[model samples]
Target: MENMHIVFWLLKDISWCMIWKPLGVAMIFPTLIISIVIAWRTRQFMSELCHNVAISVWISANSYWMISEFFHFDEHHIWGGITYKHLALIPFITGLLILMYFYLWWQPRNKEETEIIEA
Candidate 1:
């Protein structure tokens, strides 16, 4: 009876540590990619809104991963302990910042019509 109880506890612990953690991590990539594609395909005001929202979501995910690493969330985990994991945030955040800067700053101003005076 004791052995059976131990086995059950062991499996439960392993399921939480091994199965759910990786599944959560795996969900981020495809979600980000699909969001980016959908944002790009959207038109006019919706396009800008979708793109910004997607970028924000991606940045938030990267920030969460960084926080997870700094607090040693992956210390004894099956995956996500490598140095490269933290480094991956650089390009993602950089690209998002650049895109935002261009969208907000570099876009051309719309011209307003003015009445022309005839000489």
Candidate 2:
């Protein structure tokens, strides 16, 4: 399933790079769905959950950016100097903050708990 997820992700990216609007837009569903499923399945493992969630967030941002470009609104500033493409940063930063929380706070504080759970 993970490998298939990767395949969908790559197809999405390849479609984006080629400016294939239909394929790119269509690929978003499977890519995002698979990532969500993976995240749900790994909910019991903090590390996997965090990583999978980040991947899902990333795919959302990527798809949004691709759509913005496909429809030719990517560079039109919505506020100040920020374009539609820049909105993707919201999810991008969210994913980063999630990883930071996991690595800097949750993981450290729960190390023993996780280890015991795994054992």
Candidate 3:
């Protein structure tokens, strides 16, 4: 009975690592291409490019994490005391970078509008 549970868990882990991870990584390019075409038609190419790049970074992090796990690279500390499993930081940092870039650098801020908000 205990062996059956172990087998099921192993199969689930295998499917996640082999099937789902690569599938997600593989789908990014087609989605980016489609986004580019639509953006060009709408004359919003730069916006779409930024969005696609951000998406790619996020997906790349997932792929990296899975690859690292499969190869056991995630178990060792590559730099600081934290283990390589912390490689997921790439995606997290990327998300924060984009969030700060858009909110701080790109968006237009006006004092009058800021003060008038009802929230």
Candidate 4:
């Protein structure tokens, strides 16, 4: 029946079409409220620094994923030395590397127990 075909098309096409709403909810909402709250509550420079840097990394990755997947602007390198298309990725990759360094190197320093461990 025509109605059955329409139902199937709607189910398959419409349901699978949109993911931006959920992504925005997950990415934007927490960064706005929770990350800032956690950073401010700590009142320590390292903790706040780590949280803010992590947020930047997250934003860059989210933008990269959204633009590449949804807009399809990431199909191929535009050409020339580091084309315009590749420029968008610089911050994303750099942010990730910085975040990694913070987590692996800097995070451990926060736990140094000068009273117990030093003795």
Candidate 5:
């Protein structure tokens, strides 16, 4: 029946608002702590701090989206508008790039130590 379908859809919507949204917010804390530890260990303090801050901003945006989606808030008015969902990708990509840069270019070279030893 049409009524049954409507009820199912409404339940789905409510569950999305209540459960999944809060879960998204809860996920950010571990991410931030992990980022900070990794950054400190690598000695890229500034870049690590910047990247971690950027990730926090990104997580806040996600939390906003979760709140907005749950409350059925206005898509156009909120800070994390429906369109802003794509903003989550920015932090992820940025973090990946930072990691890659550290691994590929920023890591200290053993070659210099070897040359000094030979000299």
Candidate 6:
């Protein structure tokens, strides 16, 4: 399943690079769905859950960025200085924050739990 997800992700990126709008757009669904499923399946383990969820969010950000470029609005400013492409930063930062929380706070406080899970 993970391998298939990678295949879909690569296809999505390749399509984006080639400017194949329809295929790129279509690829988002499977890429995102697989990420979500992976996250859900790993939800019992905090570390895996955090990493998987972060991956899911990263894919979302990537997909949105691709779509923005496909639509030719990636450079159009939506705020004072922020462009539509910059909106992708929302999910990108969110994924980073999730990982930060896991590494900086949750994991530190739950060392025993992680160790037990690893066993």
Highest TM-score model number: 6
lDDT of each: 0.48, 0.93, 0.55, 0.52, 0.50, 0.97
TM-score of 3: 0.52
lDDT of 4 by residue, 24-60 (tens): 4344433434444544555456645565656555555
Off by over 4 Å in 3: 1-14, 17-47, 109-119
Best-performing candidate as measured by lDDT: 6
Residue 89, candidate 2: Cα error in Å is 0.3
Which model is ahead, 4 or 5, in terms of lDDT? Answer: 4
Q: Rank the candidates by TM-score, best first.
A: 6, 2, 3, 4, 1, 5
Clash number by candidate, in order: 0, 0, 0, 0, 0, 0
Q: Can you write out model 5's per-residue Cα lDDT over 9-115, one digit (the tens) per residue?
A: 34434545557655444444454445445445644344444455554454445545555566555255425444544554565666567656644664454446435
Per-residue lDDT of candidate 6, residues 44-100 (tens digit):
999999999999999999999999999999999988999999999999999999999
For model 3, residues 8-94, the per-residue Cα lDDT tens digits are 334434655565655444444454344445434544433444555565465456556766776668889877788887978878689
- Between prediction 3 and prediction 6, which has the larger TM-score? 6
**TM-score, cand. 2 vs. native:** 0.94
- TM match of model 5 to true structure: 0.38
Models 1 onward score TM values of 0.39, 0.94, 0.52, 0.43, 0.38, 0.96
Model 6: CA > 4 A from native? none
From the highest lDDT down, the ranking of the candidates is: 6, 2, 3, 4, 5, 1
| Candidate 1 C-alpha lDDT tens digits along 4-101 | 43343344345345555554444444545544554555534433544555454654455455446544663444446555455546656666775665
Root-mean-square deviation of every model:
14.7, 1.5, 10.7, 11.6, 12.8, 0.9
